[model samples]
Target: MSGIYIHVPFCKQACHYCDFHFSTSLQYVDEMTDAICTEIIMKKDRITDQVGSIYFGGGTPSILPQKSFEKIFNTLTTHFSVASDAEITIETNPDDLDAKKIAILRQLPVNRFSIGIQSFFNEDLIWMNRAHNAAEADSCIMRSQDAGFENLSIDLIYGYPLLTDEKWHSNIRKAIGLQVPHLSAYSLTVEPRTALAAAIKKGKQVPVNDEQSAAQFISLIEKSGMAGFDHYEISNFSLPGKHAVHNTNYWRGIPYLGIGPSAHGFNGNTRYLNIANNAKYMTQIAAGKLAETVEELDIYDRFNEYVMTSLRTMWGTDLSKIERDFGKEFLNDTIENSETFIRRNWLENKNGTLTLTQDGKLFADYIASELFLIDEQK
Candidate 1:
């Protein structure tokens, strides 16, 4: 089954470490909305598969007014073959949530809420330059629950320069206590071009300690596991039967259409990315062009993608798929490379499926690299 992702590239404030395409100036929201809806219609014939899920992710999808969301859904239903039982998700910040917002969202097709609750501490919120504070984070979940919404999810950042382990523990425990169904957590990495990167370069911001970050990742695994949450993906944990259908589709290599600025789409053998600039994307789409880069996937690229995405999740790399899709030589090399990591107790081959052990997960990228199909696979 395929999915559709709508990128709402507007936010009220910029997170220092965020490089995701978004603009704080929302003056172009109305035009951007129109361009996005038009693009969906224009690309209606691109993928003929039934949509199993629809995800609204972005700078903050909840930041859009209710009418904008309605228009997006109207366009989706009008142009795509969406199932009646499709799992529709929207990413939101706590500040934009209220009874009015939740009620309005529920009235539409949104079935899941991926709330950006980066921290339960006001100081961490401020450090991240998030618009929402500790108070809003505390109240929004309760308010959402009170509004009769279940299947709630939250995002958390750990090992931030300002986040102590105690503080990080508090954040995780808060979400657990709130009974959030799904949790997506990440270690803070300062990307090269972000504001946080500049601050650290000038010694204004403290550097992130890899050791500390690794420790917190371990903490997340142990704590969440003890709490009965499935470590479904390296960065995601969920209650049983509560995994994100949209993201699950992605990891399983399902096709999805991504809309708006800086969005990425994959349809098995090909991948595309929308232009990163808000203005360029809007103007191009307004001119009836898809503002994006496209690439035809080669064998090496496809095999490597499978290694990278599959190794990061509990599903591991499937040997049968490798043999079938990538051929015998590719499958053999993958198993051979995994032997060293398996000997080091970093990975496991259980029932012919290669999966990451908790210790191996800390170096997941390195392991994926070691197992990547050589360039000759191309």
Candidate 2:
């Protein structure tokens, strides 16, 4: 079984740090929904297996009207073999999840809610220009649980200028205290072309401190572990048996279909990236065409990608599988390259599986890059 991901490209407002393709204006939401459903049909043959997971990510999937969701779901059921026990999720915001909204969602197949509760602090939310207030962030969770949506996850951001070590600790504690099954926390990054980046360039905002991020990341790992949450992936934590199936499949290199403007789909050997422009995407779909570009992965690309993604998970990378699939030469080179990190206690090669040690996860990117089979090296 594979996964299906739909990217909703509309938002109520812009977060200062967000660089994902989205529009603040929502006048064309219905048209966008139509295009999304059309895209889903157009790519029907892409996945022949039953869809075990369906993720609605966004701009803000919560903002869509029930009719729009119904229309899309109708199209999906008509075309795809969605599993009986599919883990259908919708990425939502607290402000949009009113009792009325929750009731509407209950009527649909949405079983999981990934809420965007970046902070419980009003000041911090205002700084980020998020739509919801502190009160909404706190109440929405309780409300959803009371409404019987227990398969839940919430997002939190740390390492920003307004977040002190004390505040960072508080944020982690608050999420755990909420008793939700899963949590996704990320250190604030200054993406180029974002408002946060522009502010830093103009000296209007203080630059993000790498040391602060590292310290807070360490704190997050320690605190969450104490609460009995598994540090399953680089940025995700979950209680036992609560790992996100869709995202876990992604890390495992399972193929999934991506729908909507700016969405991406990956088969085992190639990637499909859709156009980011809203009007252009709609026009192309209306013309019975897909606004997508395809990239076929060469052997080196596939090997390097596997290293990058698998190294971030708790299961680690399997050297035996590498040799079986890519060849003995690749496996030999990998072992030779990993010797330095293994000696430093940053990597562990136990039972033919290479995993990042606690200290090693901090340098995950660097380590993976060093292990990559670049064309020059090939």
Candidate 3:
């Protein structure tokens, strides 16, 4: 089944380390919503399959007015064949989740929440310039649960200078105590041109330590294991039967239609990237244009993408599918190239499925790149 992703490009505050496309000036929310709805309607005939998931990710989807959600849903229902039990998700900040707001959301189609609770400590929140405080971070979950929203996922950031080992442990324990169904943890990376990078360069802030980050990552795995959560993905943990369907579909290479500025859409063989600028996107949509670029994937590109995504999951890579869909040469190349990793016990090829061991997950990106077929090989 296919999916739909709507990007809300406005935020209340700018986090120091974020590099995603977003704007703090929210005066353009109405115009942006209109543009997104128009794009969805314009491409309604694009995907005839039933939409299994609808995700509202953003600068802050919770910041939008109730009418925005209504309008978007109205457009989607009218134009596309949305499934009756579609997994609808929204990304929110803790400060935006109040009782009144939760009550309003419970009536909508948002069945799941991906809260950006980066840290449970006020010190870290201030360091990251988050909009919410420690109290709000801890309370939003209970509020959502009280509102009868059971499917909950919270994001936690590790590997920052201010995050100590003890504090990280506390963070994980906090989620366990809250009985959060899913957890997505990430290492703090200093993107170029971000405030964090600039502060580090100017010695205004402590630089990120790779050794410390690696140590924290290992701690996360062990802690989550003790809590009975499955490390299904490199940075994601979930209780049984609590995996994120939308993101799972993405890793499995299912096609999805992306809406709003800076959104991306894929159809197994081709990719579409929307214009990143908000004003320009709306202006182009007003002129009856899609404001996007498309790319057609070749055999090598598709093979490499499959290797990258499948290898990251617990399911591993399917050698038979490779041989059947690609060719014997590609399968042979994969098996031949995987010899060193297998010998090192970093990878295991059982029944023709190759999977990364616990230790190998730290180097997942490196291993995937090594297994990639180069231009000459293709």
Strongest candidate by lDDT = 2
lDDT of 3 by residue, 1-378 (tens): 899999999999899999999999989889999999999989887788999999999889999999999999999999988898899999999999999899889889899999999999999999999999999998999999988988999999999999999999999999989999899999999999799999999999998998888899999999898888988888899998898999998888999999999999999999999999999999999999999999999999999999999998888899999999899999999999999999988899989999999888988999999999977854
Q: What is the lDDT of every predicted structure here?
A: 0.90, 0.94, 0.93
Q: Candidate 1: where are CA atoms >4 Å away? A: none
Worst-scoring 10-residue span by lDDT in model 1:
369-378
lDDT of 2 by residue, 105-183 (tens): 9999999999999999999999999999999999999999999999999999988999998988888888888898899
Candidate 2 RMSD to the correct structure: 1.0
Q: Tens digits of per-residue lDDT for model 1 on 89-152?
A: 8999998897788888879878889999989999888989999999999899998888877889
Per-residue error at 136 for model 2, in Å?
A: 0.5
Candidate 2 worst ten-residue window by lDDT: 369-378
Please provide TM-scores, in order, for all candidate models, with all chains considered together: 0.98, 0.99, 0.98
Ranking by lDDT: 2, 3, 1
Each model's RMSD to truth, in Å?
1.2, 1.0, 1.0
